[model samples]
Target: MKNTILIGACLLFAQQLVKAQSSSYKPVEGKIMTEWAAQVTPENVHREYPRPQMTRENWVNLNGLWNYAIRSKGQAVPTSYDGEILVPFAVESALSGVGKTVGKDNELWYNTTFSTPKKSRNDKVILHFGASDWETEVFVNGQSVGKHKGGYDPFDFDITDHLKSGKSQSLQVRVWDPSDEGPQPRGKQVNNPHGIWYTPVTGIWQTVWLETVPEVYISGLRNASDIKSKRILVTPEVAGIVDGQQVKVSAWKDGNMIAEQTVNPAEMAKLTIKDAELWAPGNPVLYDLKVELLDGKKVVDAVGSYAALREISMAADENGIQRMMLNGEFLFQYGPLDQGWFPDGLYTAPSHEALVFDIQKTQDMGFNMIRKHVKVEPATWYHACDKMGMLVWQDMPSGDMGNGWEMKVGVLGNQSDRDRTPESEAIFREEWKEVMDDFYNFPSIVVWVPFNEAWGQFKTKEITEWTMTHDPSRLVNSASGGNFEMEGTKITGDIIDLHNYPDAKMPDPEIFGKDNILVLGEYGGLGLPVDGHVWQQKDNWGYQSFKNQDELYARYAGLIEHLGKLVEAGLSAAIYTQTTDVEVETNGLMTYDRKVIKFDVSKMKSLHSPLYNK
Candidate 1:
């Protein structure tokens, strides 16, 4: 496939006035690359469509370079500028072009200018942000438009009111990320880097841009798929009409329309298919959807999206061991441990291709599943999974500081007083809910994990119950590892998620099968070697590391083959050590730089294929 995205060469000059491209830049302090490190100016940072689940052709890409200034907290906008920082990549990331830092006591500011596409009298312009870390307040033409708190979910403000008859418009944004110094969900970031904790991403870690729409528009659409019933449900967020609004929905397979439906504003509406094509790693079938929110004679707003009919559930095998079943058949899900970090971007990847490239490479190595360990991905990542046929076991990005010995009782790291603090609990719960709400629409996500290895884990019963109630559509894994019994024979879910390191031993599956499903949450931290392709030069760590690619691949094949044998011996799914190397960890099948795929793909697939059948 011909790649290497090409835009107008004129954009190169236009981008220089905005900011430098960080993609071409490099820094010495870290391995993660930032968009600006390569000098990505406003002409291009993340020009790809931010929302892959729902897309529109008229929307514009606002990524590239922007004037950045680092000022004291609550400082007024300075007429003077510090320099250019790439949009989307945080200031801490090398890809930001300007390799600088945004700390706890400072505010990161951005200013830019763009045109309104010379509106045709009735069109309304909307400003979009894929995501920004911590807290952000936005203004356009020097007028405050809106403010958002969460870092993961996409947010936007209608900018039609801020635009004018002029050929161009001015935009401004302010951001403050507290990192690990505050109560917010900062994930695995710390001021100090050692062991697992690395760097923190602050301010505008996602794409930002503007789009023009009609006076009335379909602002959002939630597409939900039922694997058992072969139906897709869509709910639209509309703005044009109030009472008795009409919505037109269409479903397409390949290029042909298969079904159609009409419904009123808000709530569960269906678009059914006769013989639904189930989405699998080998045959990923997606159905196109065109939903329009209308008022009588005119179409107010419209959006295009796609979904696949797929199911993941826990079912008892002939031997009575509960395992993950896909499309009514057992498929022992095998995948890498994904830390979701980047050398240039830290929390963000240098480019959208860098994001999809990770998943694609993992799949190429013959794995169908990924344990998105302790991090959430941009929407485009999930969309890539949908298109590329990868299974996802999504983990809530972990945070809160407490050591191993303290986090016992299996609560999964909630032993400290912070876990007892009601305010902390509320904040964690709210942020978790925001994440669930953000990605709930993606069909590729098969499981929702609330806690891992008990890091900052507390209030297990309440949190697990809330997870189940909030998202009954997918499986819930409580405390992937804990000192105390978390499943407790009471919690309900598709699989009993267990965690162990480099050991093939199973955790007495007989006890877990009574009330809930059974599966190995983690195991097999096997490491391999390749010259000139590592995240760090020394003090590398993995559950086990090897001398060369041949030896590593051979040992890994044996390990996975042993896992396949365990499928009949009562194993459902097992998450391998990792997708790529992170910081000092070298167990990944691929190096952290992502320039190499260290495994033998065909051999790995051959060993894993039999796990589903047995």
Candidate 2:
């Protein structure tokens, strides 16, 4: 009877809290919003599991609404919040319901109350954030639990010790982001919005949740596939291992067990299948993974995961020109420069369906790859790419501008490198390493781009070599479309990439053909803005604008024809300017609202089909 009464009281308190949060809240009115915006509500905001790579069943979503206050940077927690903001959305975003700015001089504060799930003594309550911008500090019951830096990476803290012996507990978070002021990696976000730059994203911009796990559980998994040997190397990182604890990994194809292995906690487990189905674009084959943490014969913990068996390598073609080979087959890669930004949510997508919509549309357009331009997406985006069979080239978000940059397209140019301060270099290195480590498990990532257009290029050889040695499984493009720093007339990385505007152009084959793979990293920023679907009525622009769909299609077709000629001249891959119109830059195939595809879908698909033939 007493337990029932306590539960009732907790339910009543939660209801009153929800009422208080929504009574004074209103979503910010933005000029453009996607169709999914109307479907958004605090009760249903980003309810999907944020992390698809590693998932557990016993988890509580702490999304919904939370009390928020913006205060001076060094101020204490406010006695009362200013208003309620939607979780997983930035405060400056229209979807967050609190379109306010929190600069370096100010801090964004969030407060909420959650009930602790009933758990055994050996269970640990893990608080997870899919991502938060810049610096974040967490407190539980007024006790500081932990702090994390880096805006693009997911982090967690074990708050089991801070939870009092009660049905409810208080949670607080403080965040600070300097945006373009600091030398951190913030891509295209400035204090002021303009062309190619958008509004700043501050505070919690991804899902926040709580999960329970056993004291001794699986921390992480790294799987690498060797297509030649038909074997998968699995390195499982386990925490709190004791004697008699074993890690078991089972791989399944079409719900049938293909291979299984058991190994000790720290040892690497190799699962060999007799005939592994290779993963490739247009025919994505993934094997289901079941991992178990066993104490003797009893299963203490189990997780659902997945993997793909594929390999990416660079080799000289029949003409002695370098090309990219996927599963030992030379396939021409072509796709768009996908800046993962939303019209309403900035860094965060409105919903999981909306997130998957872009990838699906790209696939429907018959593209094979995507160069994720200067932003890391949620794990679910990568997971969707894995399942849908789209290749990826991940870029580290560029920052610390005003470096001495050189743009040389035809000649082998050596530009003066940026002399970043020690602190700036450390910040870049640490965050780059974290980004790589966090997204290393995804099979769709074929290349890592550390610098773009020399935006933050420094210590070129050192950074490129570090990235190569760090992950030898994938190729590296040292500086995509940046000045080619030569070491005795040889480019440093695997691909010699170039950039051109509104036309398909590649590096001079005679100059770069023998040494490195030629690629047009970015081109064709053809724009067509639709009425009622633009971020602003005036001042919207693209590399080249068209008045009608017919004109856009004709020009786009001509670019593809030119691109095909480059393919014959040893060009390997190319990335179009962008996937969607972001902010005032109307260069995307789709409008900012995502309500219209500017070109005919069937014709676009047909035009892109010939690029893959070579």
**Residues 1-614 of candidate 2: C-alpha lDDT, one tens digit per residue:** 99999999999999998777665555689558888988888878888887777778999999988899999989998899998889989999988998888888999999999997779998999999988988999999999999998889899999989999888999999999999998888988899999998899998988899989999999888887888888877788888898889999988888899899999987888889777889999889888888898998999898878777899988888888888889988899999999999988889998999999999999999899999999999998999999999999999998888765556544333466788999889989998998899999899999999998888789988999899999999989998886666765457888888887988888777767778888889999999887788899999999999998889889999999999998988999999988999999888989877999987888889988988887
326-398 per-residue lDDT for model 1 (tens digits): 8888777778778888776788876777788888878876778888887788898998898888889888876
lDDT of 1 at 125: 83
Candidate 2: worst 10 consecutive residues by lDDT? 405-414
- Candidate 1: misplaced stretches above 4 Å? 1-42, 117-123, 403-420, 483-488, 492-494, 528-531
**Native-structure RMSD, model 1:** 5.0
The global C-alpha lDDT for each of the candidates, from Candidate 1 onward, is 0.74, 0.88
Model 2 residue 260 CA deviation (Å) reads 0.6
Quality of model 1 by C-alpha lDDT: 0.74
Report the number of backbone clashes for model 1: 44
TM-scores, all models, native as reference: 0.90, 0.96
**Residue-pair clash count for candidate 2:** 0
For candidate 2, what is the TM-score? Answer: 0.96
